[model samples]
Target: MAEKRDYYEVLGVGKDASDDDIKKSYRKLARQYHPDVNKAADAEQKFKEVKEAYDVLSDNQKRATYDRYGHVDPNQGFGGGGGGAGDFGGFGDIFDMFFGGGGGRRDPNAPQRGNDLQYTMTIEFKEAVFGKETDIQIPRTETCDTCSGSGAKPGTKPETCTICHGSGQQEVVQNTPFGRIVNRRACTNCSGTGKVIKEKCGTCHGAGKVKKQRKIHVRIPAGVDEGAQIRLSGEGESGVRGGPAGDLYIVIRVKSHEFFERDGDDIYCEVPLTFAQAALGDEIEIPTLTEKVKLKIPAGTQTGTYFRLKGKGVPRLRGYGQGDQHVKVTVVTPTKLSDEQKELLRQFSGTEGEATPQEHHETIFEKMKKAFRGE
Candidate 1:
């Protein structure tokens, strides 16, 4: 009936309207036909149609396809008998643009979210290992307190842009090889805001934002390693036009520990021991992230032997309890010996066994030597 009015006309906009115009008009119509806003019997159907129109018109490629092929089948916008309408940018993009959540332009009339801010924080090894909560002061652009990000002076309000007529864009026709090609671009005078500030806010100089230094406490989670990023939501620079503030990203840098090395969930340390302890066995106290734990050195322990003290390492990042601390033993040789020690070693050498067959620990030569010796 009535040939199902053209989508562009259904939204009451020119065929040559810019993308912003199509979006603005679609938003207005969608809000008007929303079931909650309008109790009309055909509100749902009309809302779907408006959404369909916006979906096709919002994308440059889809709009071009539709412009060339109309509503005819095989038109790229058809989409398996009209099923591909909602697969464009998703409903979130549409909602974010209109509601001021996706970094879009703020309506000189709505509450906006704050802008996201980033800060680099360097922490000591102990603080990152044990966790610390500290406050940092940062200077950023925040919402103006005087005008509340309105960019208007005193009690005045921002007026709609007359050049783009609240569409934030304008069209210009250009001569091309393929006839005339019409293109839309943001208005240069008003910067595509569709509104110009006649009287500016005295506090912010009509920018609707102010620079201020604010202190915010950041919590460093235990087991956070170097280059770890911590996100503090809703703690960034203030938004404009009454928008909410953005998020804060804290990048962590952990200083190296002198005695310990970290490998993921494992804590490693090299413990040095005298040759006497490595040969005769001894209990040595080792340092860990927590308390000092005593480790036993077995007799004949090699220099590279690793001993593990369970649950004595740094805490796991995303799993269970702490990790095991690995202690790598390093044997120290005696550089200077006393005269009594040399005499005692000479006496011990005199009690050594008589001449015997040479034994090879790693080959069949040991068995052959035993056979030649006749036991």
Candidate 2:
């Protein structure tokens, strides 16, 4: 496989580009390389690349992830700042040694954001196409009401830690050949919380939070494809020390439709037509996303020919208008035939090329009808 280009580079936009700027660039490129409009051999591939880039950049969450971690390989999962996790860890270690910066020495009482949560939801194909509003229950940690997030009993309060003077970190000095090195570690006396609750809160057992189930209502929009995520703001675990709550991500898994196959917003399916119908042409009912509509098959239609139904596919995820539905027709040949039918076919074979295909088709239909009536 070839290496992929940067998404921003693919869309020809800067990292700080606005959402409208990204969408505008995508629309321009989509029209420029549309396979139906551009006849170049690589037009389809270019269109796919543009679509992929837009899919990532147009999504705020995905774009932020890309910005933080450049080019995360989908098959290999997310990598760190550089190389494997060990290399990233080693780099962090070197930085911490030079500058007094590490998580071990951080202020424990500082406000910290809660951890984000993820839930996988499987929905029906029609539900994904049409959208839905539903409720889900998930277990998460929440701040204790009784303790007021302080881990203290009802009438009591927490006291500052005696060790480390409420800094929550213990420091040590070592004399080296180059200079004296100062190392810091979390103070074990207060468990790095910078406060001690002599009488622990019975509700939370000295912790400032409690585990509970939360009900969240989610709205899945129309045209959501597989693996697409919906972000719910501040619906994750409760924050620590008055910090902001994290977000909850709902990942969608759309079940496969029995007949319809989707590619982007386009719908594709195949319909079978009998020999007479293919040769003589007919108006047949084709199923769209919403309803069944009549599709005209021109006379002398060949197998594998596709007819497009405009505005019959899925709605665009971001903007107005609907995609197209592509219907391919395959001709089915008869396997079992009556003796009279065989004779008629033989006669037609003897006179092959003597009449137009339409005439032959009409002749076969009439003969078959008469045979059915025992004429």
Candidate 3:
């Protein structure tokens, strides 16, 4: 017979390689040499070799025994039976690789937490700017009052599972070419709860919960933006058996405002100004999140100029202070003019050495080009 290769060498890992490293190396080799992917004549044998190496290296106890004795002895406490390394079949190793290795059993009667629930709420724009408290109704599972959440009929209790003896797990032993392999998994008979209800509750029909509509009071904080989420603990579905209840998440959706636009904590709005106001400054009333505020537009202010109103924007959701409001000015020109208004504008244009709008535009464009060229 051909001599067996070193397990670490077969997996291309060091003798002292970490468990994660060993697993990674084994997975890489297994994928490369798998028969379905690689049609090489020796691919199956190479795949088997990789699986064997992983199975032994992944198990602390088996790896320790192999390291000390140079090989595993099946008759000993660690090994399944007296067998050579080549005895390992490919199928059993593949099963172990996919399903996972052995581990301690779990108690089936343990309580499990309930599932969480989510609710999306739409609120007015002003309501998001300022905090509000509201009530909402939601349908969720509540503990069954009829049987006191035991899932058993009145005056009766759940009986321990006979298959797993209330341990909630079962031990499975399989004889492979590598020897006898042992694994512990959840009990099938009791469904891993290690308890069974023979006389089920009539109201819940063996389920420890019942569906009902519940009213919840939620407080939305000031300055909460769209897509914000609030968590309410112990407000979700009731737990299975006697477990603890889960939480409820409230997602907030703020409606759009007609005039105000919000960015972070800052608020912005556009205000139209007459041509005279742009040339000569004036105090104007602008809309803010809470109320209308007065803003001073400086003399000779151009279109698209911004005026700041400190502490007139949205409140900070987390910090102590509020944000400022910015007002963008848009100068409006008269579209229709009276004969007297036109004559005054013509005289004003004559003094400025521009007689027509076309001449004024060309002169300004020429000056802009010269300025840009540093003339």
Can you give the TM-score per candidate against the true fold?
0.61, 0.65, 0.70
- Poorest 10 consecutive residues of model 2 by lDDT? 76-85
In model 1, what are the clashing residue pairs, if there are any?
Answer: 111-242, 111-243, 112-242, 112-243, 112-244, 113-244, 114-244, 114-245, 114-246, 161-194
* lDDT against the true structure, each candidate: 0.71, 0.76, 0.75
**Which ranking of candidates, highest lDDT first?**
2, 3, 1
Error of 2 at 121 (Å): 0.7
lDDT of 3: 0.75
Ranking by TM-score: 3, 2, 1
Q: Compared to the true structure, candidate 3 yields what TM-score?
A: 0.70
- What is the TM-score of candidate 1? 0.61
**Candidate 1, 1-375: lDDT as tens digits:** 444457788778998999879878977887678554579999977876776677677778877887777777474644222233333333434444443444555343455677788999999886877799999998888878888777889889778888878767676755422123334568776787777888999999988888889998889989888999999888888875556779899999989766677887788877665656776788976767766667888877988899998987777777779888888886654445566655755665321122222232212333323323432
Give the Å shift of residue 61 in candidate 3. 23
Best of the two (2, 3) by lDDT: 2
Q: Report the number of the highest-lDDT candidate.
A: 2
Which TM-score value belongs to model 2?
A: 0.65
